[model samples]
Target: RPGKEPEVDLPYYHPRAPSAEVEMTAYVLLAALKTEPAPSQEELSFSSLIAKWISSQQNPNGGFSSTQDTVVALQALSQYGAVTYAKSGAASKVTLRSGGEFQQDFQVDATNRLLLQRVPLPQVPGEYSTEVSGEGCVYLQTSLRYNVQPMQEDAPFTLHVSTIPETCADSKAHKVFDIGINVSYTGERNGSNMVIVDVKMLSGFIPLKSSVRKLERHPIIERTELSTNHVLVYLEK
Candidate 1:
């Protein structure tokens, strides 16, 4: 099969950091906003939320991952701001609350609107709420950072890697050995997206070019790449 785009089904904005997916999503939202019929309040609300989220991904240098993403994100954010801007001017306050345990306030005013202010989240694995009052367009965004360890109990996928020729019974085995890889998906879904396997060669060893070409021709593999210190195998789902 040929290469294709991935499908993101998670409940979060994205599974990883800012990338082309985020840029495309922002463009899609902008397209939705420009449709013939006016969007419902619910859709507008959702779009606003997405716009703020994209804004939060902005780099300190005032750009996204690339120039294209930066342009689209800025266009979407500007449009959202125009649509939701309040006529009256007043200082706005954002409140971050986690259940009944913690509460913090962030004030946004003309004096501090251009400045960047941030506070660390007090807890992890907690439900938090953001509310804004006396607003003239106060954007509040929460970022989530967490580690993803291998799933021990109910992993969606499993990988096994081994090398042939346990012993140097054959002289050539010392110089070149075939690598064996077995992967299985046991998740609820039919399968996963594309998987990339990076096999790093030993300091003095490298993959054989002919071997890489053979792997690249396999039906299950999309492409193969050989570098100075590693071999990359692209596998299809």
Candidate 2:
């Protein structure tokens, strides 16, 4: 077992071990220290010292970087509520402009709210626009559109109904019904009306009573006992 590359338990690696980037190393060490149970008073003091050291390296633009450092240090400090070089202290403010451009400023604040203002935009004339506000946190912004069309007075119609087996074994077969309504009007360029048709499926050869007196006159036809599996109905007018 001497040269057998000691079964290195990868997960228990040291918290203070150097990473490829100093910022990443500090972040990982801080995270580990935060999670470790019953850390000694000396360890706590060391963690505070490192936090201050990382805070000192904060960048003016809210992003930290060194020539040899792969990870940005200011961003890491922002996550831990530490003020790097940000005038506002703990929050990173990002400003976005048209054409997919953005700028970021970092600040450390004890209160979480980060107020950003004075964002300038290029003006476009004669275009109607409105902004909507909502309560709770503003996590995202998006645009939406809605359109409405006039209903048709005269249109063709179709109706269908059937019984099918339920997916679950313990349940009985269910009578599934679907009504397809299609209406088209020709004269004067009028919109189509939605015709609501009532459908009924009788189990046996006996005909079921229907509120609709006759299918043809009512702009609909009710077909019953067409087959053992299902029944079909449609608008006769």
Candidate 3:
């Protein structure tokens, strides 16, 4: 009796699977780029392709998805200029404005500890915020709003964010610093559904690395594989 307790049936629950829309969209974009001809070899533009795709996905309120789809879309669009595509009757310009520039100053103390003076960035519509500070560590915060629906201002939510540093290699410097923000969602039922449409910031650093090694190795394609009819057979069979 002490070793064997009554077997009780617990509720079966499954967490939602990861979204594949982002990956699928990216694959489609790449395929489109490969099949579509460019106006000129010098004029090849991935941005235009991405912009077109993003435009189709944009919600009526100007916000994108909070899922990976949104992340890939934003990253691809960011690679291009402010605009991605132009239609006949639509606005001739598509400007992607996150907000004002992020500013930071660096200083060194007598103890050689690096000091960072980060200027507070103002909040923007459809944004989020996060902050962190500690010894040799930093934190990140962000907010994003759902463009598909209007949310109450007092609702609780979260955002997707990542931090990266700008490189100083061209300047002969060994390091650089930067951060990033994106949209995400987090809330409990009956709590809040509002997405924070405003600016959010995260803090971190770039530790200098002396020796760089490739994290991934490229596979070698043999000459025989390229020259033989066996290539097709090998690929298919």
lDDT leader: 1
- TM-scores, all candidates, are 0.41, 0.22, 0.21
User: What ranking of all candidate models by TM-score puts the best one first?
Assistant: 1, 2, 3
At residue 214, give the lDDT of candidate 2. 42
Candidate 3 residue runs with Cα over 4 Å from true position: 1-19, 27-50, 82-237
Better of 1 and 3 by TM-score: 1
**Which candidate leads the pack in TM-score?**
1
lDDT of 2 by residue, 92-157 (tens): 333343433334332323354445333333333223232223222222222222345656665333
TM-score, candidate number 3: 0.21
Better lDDT candidate (1, 3):
1
Model 2 scores worst on lDDT over the 10 consecutive residues at 135-144
Candidate 2 TM-score versus the reference: 0.22
**Candidate 2 ranges with C-alpha deviation above 4 Å:** 1-21, 31-34, 38-41, 66-237
The models' CA-based lDDT, in order, is 0.76, 0.40, 0.37
What does the lDDT come to for candidate 1? 0.76
Q: Give the alpha carbon lDDT tens digit for every residue of 143-174 in model 1.
A: 66555565568878788988787666999988
lDDT for 90 (candidate 2): 38
Residue-by-residue lDDT tens digits, candidate 3, 1-237:
024333533332222122355446655554444443443433335535555555555553444656666666555554433232323232111122233544333332324332323333465442423332323222121223333444557434445645453455555333443334444334456543322233222223322222111111213211112111111111110
Candidate 1 residue pairs in clash (backbone atoms < 3 Å): none
